[model samples]
Target chain A: EAEVAQSPRYKITEKSQAVAFWCDPISGHATLYWYRQILGQGPELLVQFQDESVVDDSQLPKDRFSAERLKGVDSTLKIQPAELGDSAMYLCASSLDVGGMDEQYFGPGTRLTVT
Target chain B: AQSVSQHNHHVILSEAASLELGCNYSYGGTVNLFWYVQYPGQHLQLLLKYFSGDPLVKGIKGFEAEFIKSKFSFNLRKPSVQWSDTAEYFCAVSPTYNTDKLIFGTGTRLQVFP
Candidate 1:
């Protein structure tokens, strides 16, 4: 099974510091998604990418968070000046394409803790 | 805005007990429904999905769900559950059959005991 790969599975940083998470989806997937899951809430979409182009980022907090897939494969999500409220599990998901009919596969996720 | 509702916040079940989790989405047009599970410290995984055809769809681990168009709901069910089945369940929906975004519900936490 070609599962999604993610690095820095666990991270702990002080408030006002910078943190980054990386994700490499299954081979041949075209659509990628980044989501944030609060302690008690379900995952919420933060950004979506079709290849290297961002298709939707309506929910992304661009002021402090940024994401990019430079080569249309592996992706990076960064949060500069992280805040205490930003502590959560950052999940990366991907599908064959932007079509919603296809199933989305999720990575193990990066758990971030801001103190 | 499109939203998903999961009425059951938490459910506790013993071994061999039946299971049912409710999921409702507010979308009048065509929609795709799905159930995802998250075990403790595990990755979120697909349980089942409904795009079209038969309303009742079966998934891995003896789980099944029924998509009721009239009720705008998809409820997951299992004849019996095991202690290993304890996890959080989330219901998601896409406004259209093939859209770019997937909206998820708050989620329901299930705790199973032997």
Candidate 2:
């Protein structure tokens, strides 16, 4: 089965350091999503991309976080000067299109820990 | 902005036991509902989804969910569960008429004993 691929499954860094996560969605998927999951909580959308264009980033903390999918196939999410509270599971998901009924395949996630 | 609520945080069951997980969303517009499962160390996988149809939808692994429009709810259920069913389940909602961004609820972790 085609699955989303994520690198650096785990990351540990001190507060004020920078961290990055990477994701490669299944081929032919046009919609990509980045989410953060605090322990014991649901995943919250940070950004959404459609064919290399950002569709929604209302919840993204632009001051410290940034994401890009230049080719619309693979993506990268970065957090500069990470804070203690920024520790969470960074998840990547992708789907065929924007319809809500489309199945979004998720990656294994990169667990970030800031001490 | 929309939100999803899952009342159960954790559930423990033995093999052959029935299972039900509650999920509710606060949205006034047309919506799509889904149930996703995550086994330990595995990625999240869609179990079922309800777009528009007869409220009841059946999914893989003997799982099903009912969408109640009036209640703004979609509840997942399984008549007989096995030890392999131990995993975390998440309920999500998307406002079809508005945006396609998926809003998820605090997940429910199921620990099934053999």
Candidate 3:
């Protein structure tokens, strides 16, 4: 069973510090997604990537958040000058393609805590 | 914009008890519905999905869901459950083709007791 890999299972940072999380999806997956899961709430889409190109980032907080998938393999999500409310579980998921209603496989999320 | 709603926030059940979780989506066009489960200390895993054809879809661990287009509902049901089934379940929807951005509803946390 191919599983998505994530780094730094847990993170603790100061409110004004910068934080970054990494994700490596299953091999040959062309579509990748980043989501934020607040406590007691479902995951929310932050960004979507097809290969190395971004497809949708309407919900991403561009001012402080950025995500990139170079060469369409692994991806990195960064939050600069994190705020207290930015603490949440960041999940990364991937699928075979952006179409065809493929099932997306998710990685164990990186839990962020800002104090 | 598409949105998913889960009626139950938390549910408790004993072993071998039947289970049903309500999920509704707000989208007029063609859509794909799915149910995902997250066990403690584990990542989200796909339970089942509804794309087309048969409205009733069966998934792993004896789970099933029916896609009621007229009601915009995709409710998950299981005839019998075990203590291992205790987990958080989420309902999600995405537009067919084009993009695959998923909109998920607030999860339902099920506590199955033995």
Please give each candidate's TM-score: 0.96, 0.97, 0.97
Q: Per-residue alpha-carbon lDDT of model 3 for A1-115, expressed as tens digits?
A: 9999998999999998999999999999999999999998999999999999999999999999999998889999999989999999999999999784778999999999999
Per-model i-RMS in Å?
Answer: 1.4, 1.5, 1.6
Better of 1 and 2 by DockQ: 1
- Writing each residue's lDDT as its tens digit, candidate 2 over A17-95 gives 9999999999999999999999999899999999899999999999999999999899999999899999999999999
lDDT (C-alpha) at residue B95 in model 1: 71
Off by over 4 Å in 3: B97-99
Q: If the candidates were sorted by their lDDT against the true structure, best first, what order would they fall in?
A: 3, 1, 2
- Write candidate 1's Cα lDDT for A17-101 as tens digits: 9999999999999999999999888899999999999999999999999999999999999999899999999999999987776
Clash-forming residue pairs, model 2: none
The full ranking of all candidates by DockQ, starting with the best, is 1, 2, 3
For model 3, what is the alpha-carbon lDDT of residue A60?
96
Clashing residue pairs in candidate 1 (N, C-alpha, C atoms within 3 angstroms):
none
lDDT of each: 0.93, 0.93, 0.93
Which structure among the candidates has the greatest DockQ? 1
